[model samples]
Target: METVKRVLVTPEAKKVIDQLSKQHGKLMFHQSGGCCDGSSPMCFKEGTFRIGSSDVRLGEIAGCPFYMSRSQFEYWKHTQLTVDVVKGRGASFSLEIPLGVRFVIRSRLFTEEEFARLEPIQNG
Candidate 1:
């Protein structure tokens, strides 16, 4: 069976991850659909932030687990999300704000073949 990835990290994003990991040890990501942060993906030191029951683990990017609210996941389930880094501080509390870059999500809808091979998501 083919393996379909739900989440991925661009090389630019991976470089940021490497830097973050060195400074913070381990990390994780959570997609912010709205609220104060807008739609930016927030990165945190693993275990520093709480994962609630309403969250769903989509997959990992750059070896860090990525999650989103279950409600948000419903809207994004049919798409593949790529973590990309962009210059400018987003309206997020993510660690990258201090570095003058923010992690953003770029998505592409999954083809029928890819959707069939997608990994399962875990409910938090």
Candidate 2:
């Protein structure tokens, strides 16, 4: 994928990434944005992030690794964030943060149909 911001995925997410890497040969990160808040870094199976035109670059967070678009990196530069995994019931990836920050949960990456449903909220 294109280079973007550098971000870190939590250790909980590492297990999933390890599995995905096995299945897909490897896994990388990619994040986008929401309207009201700053750009949200997310994980992508395999994608492109062009700097300048883009914003984020792939990197590590806390200790775990993730991808961030170039724009997102610059926008979120010097910002400290929390990343964790929430399981049980309908388990989800939670980007523990202050108001206005967001991250793409794992479920949304599965399909465009499902992603579209949440697009309004993410984009709004």
The best candidate by lDDT is 1
- The Cα RMSD in angstroms, rounded to one decimal, for candidate 1 relative to the true structure is 0.8
TM-score (C-alpha, index-matched) for candidate 2? 0.44
Compose the digit string of candidate 2's lDDT tens values, residues 53-123. Answer: 44433345433345444555455444434444444322213222222223433321223343233211111
Query: In model 2, where do residues sit more than 4 Å from their true spots?
Result: 1-6, 35-40, 47-52, 61-65, 88-124
Q: Considering every candidate listed, which one attains the maximal TM-score?
A: 1
In model 2, what is the error at residue 93, expressed in angstroms?
A: 13
Native-referenced Cα lDDT, model 2: 0.40
lDDT per residue (tens digit) for residues 53-74 in model 1: 9999998988899999999999
Error at 96, model 2, angstroms: 18
Q: Model 1 reaches what TM-score against the true structure?
A: 0.96
